[model samples]
Target: MRKTLPLIIFITLTGTMYALGQSAKAIIPLGGNAWVTGKATITDDGLTNWENPQDAISIYFRVDKAAELTFALRVRVPEGKSKISVTIGKHTFSKQVANTGFDTLSIGKVMLQPGYIKVDLKGISRSGNVYADVTDLIVEGVQSANELTYVRTGSSFHFGRRGPSVHLRYNIPQEIKKDVKWFYNEITVPQKMDVIGSYFMADGFSGGYFGMQVNSDTERRVLFSVWSPFNTDDPKSIPDSLRIKLLTKGDKVHGGEFGDEGSGGQSYLLYPWQAGKTYAFLLEAAPDKLYNSTTYTAWFKETGTDKWLLIASFSRPQTFGYLTDLYSFVENFEPDNGDKIRMAYYTNQWLGDSAGKWHAVTGAKYTGDETARKNYRKDYSGGLKDGRLYLRNGGFFDDLTPLNQKLEYRTSLPPPMIDFNQLPR
Candidate 1:
């Protein structure tokens, strides 16, 4: 039976940070869920899940840090004379699998870094053109070989089973109230992943969020919208006067990608995007003419480009007037086959006030979906890697967990708080 879970409690914000150390030794798997290059595909034949590639292929994954590693691969050589060669850095090992069933091959230990590492496999010889088949890669023992860093690539907390995704956020130090003008960040869509959800938002009685997304290989867009304090899903339940609008010319508005749980609006299909490219996004919110109303606006510019295109705007009455949260996340939209690895790099985050002053946001806390926190199902992975935030999810991982950690906790300040009690009945 599926279990119901409560929303995660927000961690207190402060200036203190837990000193993270080197990655401890654990068995890390490189399999269908892992990122690969140079010709590989995942296949399941009713029983086993395996990755097969044409001869001379390489697979990549990150480790917490440098360590002496004992590598293992489950192999199936179709013929008696078939042979395979596996190489890691300067080391190489050869083996012959004369049986039809899968067998294990242990490639002895070697030193490796805590970040990304590539393992190469070559089909040396096989009879009648039969290719050698194998499962995933695994490391047996580990010994830290480098100094502790902020993030580790191959950490277990970063990947998992199939389901909803995870999130990472940096709360702004100053409360972006009715007078604040903007929240900004420069981010890159990570190469080789399928989707990323990013946004700058404020938490209040009525919450508002805006950002860009890479939903699929072909679909990329910038989205902006606001959640009404009302709880009804029916758009008609809310007057047209309260709906969000696209103030900019040449932009399209569409139904929000989020499901029906509240009164929310979205403007999307506004622009096209590419992978591995950086784009700057700015979201502005301030009090409107009404005493308790606020106007929300969004702007975007691709890196190396000068124009900051206006995306959309919406005005909410009887609401908090400032931006409260600056956060981003990675998720899989297509549930059936949607669970594939995807990531995005976020940096240069800044918060802007009505006075035209900007403050830098250099650190943040890591969190995940409530379902993932309650269920042991391993379906997502992500966190701060090499000083930038990254998120990964989908595939066949059954032991992956979410990376949930917060840096400095600031008192006298509160993140945008969602008022569930005030939600429309």
Candidate 2:
């Protein structure tokens, strides 16, 4: 079932926010949904970083019906008159404003079908220090019999702009339900889909994630991390007994602590992994019920390579269980690159039992985070493609995969043949 956020339309005025249900006019804060190019940026008060006419901004929203939608903008000229334009598809609306104070400027209307819509806002002509500082997009015409989806105000705009993170929850067969000791998966990101800031997570369990990332133009990484048994997000606050103790790391890999999204022991190798090449990830969990602890180790390598370079190993003090809640995911860790679309194909998933037998994964469930569930930035989809489970997000695409949609690859992929004893310690 698609878990959609309630029909809570937000209206921001005088630095305050209020929610209304299917109102005549709903405010879509640019701070939450705008993707800026050039020198333009998003601020707490909205689009205040715009200072150049050459800069461009894109605002995305999804409408669920074919309707004539009216548009308006809340903006400030600061000094003199400025002319700005809002373009949607083939329709463009331009208006002139000279309001020193923030005021609403109507930007005409358009007939739109049911899908994701992009509103391109740019400066046309201005006689001020900067172009219009736009704050919000006020939309009407969808009230009683229509549905609309956009990132709402009064929340963290960073996550809103970074868009939704989707996951593939792999279904481990019931026969291997108890002592699944290892998880193995492969990821192949398509060419041109390797947008910066994308983390194509290949292996994710209840306690940690292992993946490859397009860190920046000059950097790529094979990253791995495991959470501490403590519940705090601050790594420094975790008690030594409950903290994730680093066992070892590979040569040239940086090992340290990470925080803010569940503090954990972090390690990464600065490898220039490229798109279009399949990379392999293997994660192992060894639980000791007597000591109430579990040790997790991660390894990554190219598919054709004979070596599995160990990423890192961590021992969580308060947990004692085999790997459960297995999954893989695709997410944008950096909000600045959220406008660009990225995707990856996860294939040949297998689980290794305690008896050293490999089980082929046949089923998975596609899901999204709070962003997609709340209907904020709906450009996310996932399903089985060519014997592989693929996940996609961003780019403002119209296609949507159903939330919790079950995806299965019926063909039997070749299971991995590994000498477990020869793995790096």
Candidate 3:
């Protein structure tokens, strides 16, 4: 059986103007059934079911023009089953209730042609019993023209049971001489699993430049490895420095032993993360360096090996001063790098210093053995012996020969396979 609450609406000024220079108009009202014995408080915090037997609720509003839309709703289901739905005209978006506590739902850019909008809530019950509560609903109007657009790569990268499609967005700052690359990813999971995703960026001179790793599931441990040129401010210098960081979900995961400091060392930093949590990686690069800032999240589930999936990459480029960010989603990822598991990070580049001196840092290798992956630590570092070196000329701004030295490599000792049922969904 399903029960629903009365319709409620609320509106606030958003300071949005149309092309005609008129303030955009929207209609909203304080939500909930006013006739109820106790007032149903509705705020941005989300919706809650105060009365157990109450039916579902629906809210309606209107937009005068075509625009993008964003909204939030809170729902609480103490027992049984319930769901919230967002309806724009005839199209309805809905999600099933999982947790008994309050859960927040957010919908990204949706095109709203001038029409009526309605959000409906339905109480789900098994054996003719309904158990659920709902409260606050907030809606915001966004301009369609202002939304950032992206190009879909059609190709997808598969990790574990999860598969995430690739999208790329490029931005070139006016002043910087370097390119800032932005790699956008959309990950879809059929089920769920414990998962970790990361990207390695490097030049030849320094061993590896910068590494960013994100763990989507907090309950299980994840192993990460990377090899690159050193880290330096000069674009003309070959990579010679290498640094690696190990991360874990529970306590601090140990990273392998790093080489001596300055030569190419390793460091460990404990990041506050929870099990069954999803996180995003925002990596930025200016003319001379790259770094990470802020993190967004999603929930983690354990399902068959085919359940957990990830879509991520390190291809975005940024101008000298501007920052570029990349995002990844992990759902139902489990750690079971069965035999044939292959993981690797590789890169190559040439740099010319301010002295007009050009040196090529080529043939760099930072490989991790089987033991490294098996006993994965939160903090560790080491060097590879297979790396190379090269030399180039000055006054030459373009040289494909030296720049082409950059390459990436990966070999799975056991090979990667989709082990869906092996995970906890």
Please report, as a residue range, the 10-residue window in candidate 3 with the lowest summed lDDT: 148-157
Q: Score candidate 3 by lDDT.
A: 0.29
Task: Indicate the worst ten consecutive residues by lDDT in candidate 2.
Answer: 11-20
Number of the top candidate by lDDT?
2
1-425: candidate 1 lDDT, tens digit per residue: 99765433222132111122322232323332333333444332111222233435554444555667667776665555567778888888887757687767676787876554567776666663345566556454543322211112232223232344566677665454444456766667666653443222221123655666655556677776677655567756776555544344324546442336566666665467776788777776767555566767666678676556666666665664677655776665443243345556666666667666766664677777643564322456665567666655654343354467765422222222222223121
Which residue segments of model 1 deviate by more than 4 Å?
1-162, 174-179, 195-206, 215-217, 240-242, 245-259, 289-291, 397-402, 408-425
lDDT of 3 by residue, 118-151 (tens): 4555443432133345544444553332221111
Estimate the TM-score of every prediction. Answer: 0.54, 0.93, 0.22
lDDT per model vs. reference: 0.53, 0.86, 0.29
Off by over 4 Å in 3: 1-56, 107-109, 124-131, 140-425
Predicted candidate 2 versus true structure: per-residue lDDT over 268-320, tens digit per residue: 99999988899989999999788899999998889988998989988989899
Ranking by lDDT: 2, 1, 3
